[model samples]
Every structure is written in C-alpha cells, then in structure tokens.
Target: MGNYEQFHLIVKWKEQALMIESLLFLFLNIILSDKKQPVSSTPKTYIYDT
Candidate 1:
C-alpha cells in the first residue's frame, strides 16, 4: 500500500509537470505566431499586389 501511494504521487507529479510544460509550449507558440504572422504575411501580400 505504501508503494502504491508513492507510485500514485509520482504519477500525479509527472502529470502536473507535463501539463505545465505543454501550457508553456502553447503560450510560446501563440506569442511567436502573433509576432510572425504580420511580418510573414505582409511580404506575400505586397508581392501579389505589385
């Protein structure tokens, strides 16, 4: 029973770590996309317009 409790605690800790990591990843992606979207898309639009 003690071992099982330890295992469960480890699993829960790992899950929380993974959740935080993924949330950070998603946040970074959103920030990067916002920064890149205008810079990347404007050139294409200008080229097409010209």
Candidate 2:
C-alpha cells in the first residue's frame, strides 16, 4: 500500500475530527462566551415580599 492510500483512509477520519472540533467550538462559545448585554435586576419586593 502507498502513502496516498493511507492518506485516503485518514481523510475519512479527519472529517469526523473536523466535525467534532466545530461542535466543540460552538458548545464552548455557547457555554463560556460572555454575551455582551446589559443585565437588569428585578425589584426585590415583587418576589421576595410575597
């Protein structure tokens, strides 16, 4: 078997690796990204007093 044949076999695996990387990148962003938005504090009396 030549190196290209080995490379061809590896290429299929590389696609799975690329997909995993993309999903991990997306998940990390969703979980760790500091979404730039103003946070509003709700009035304490509304819920706390009840």
RMSD in order of candidates: 12.5, 15.2
- Number of clashes found in candidate 2: 0
Query: What alpha-carbon RMSD in Å does predicted model 1 have with respect to the real structure?
Result: 12.5
Worst 10 residues of 1 by lDDT: 41-50
Clashes of 1: 0
TM-score, per-candidate, Cα-based: 0.67, 0.51
Residue 3 CA displacement from its true place in model 1, Å: 1.0
Specify the highest-lDDT model's number.
Answer: 1
Model 2 spans > 4 angstroms off: 1-5, 34-50
The models' CA-based lDDT, in order, is 0.66, 0.60
Per-residue lDDT tens digits for candidate 1, residues 1-50, read 99999999999998888778767766765787788753343322222111
Candidate 1 residue runs with Cα over 4 Å from true position: 37-50
Per-residue lDDT of 1-50 in model 2, one digit per residue for the tens? Answer: 69999999899888878778767765655554468432345422232221
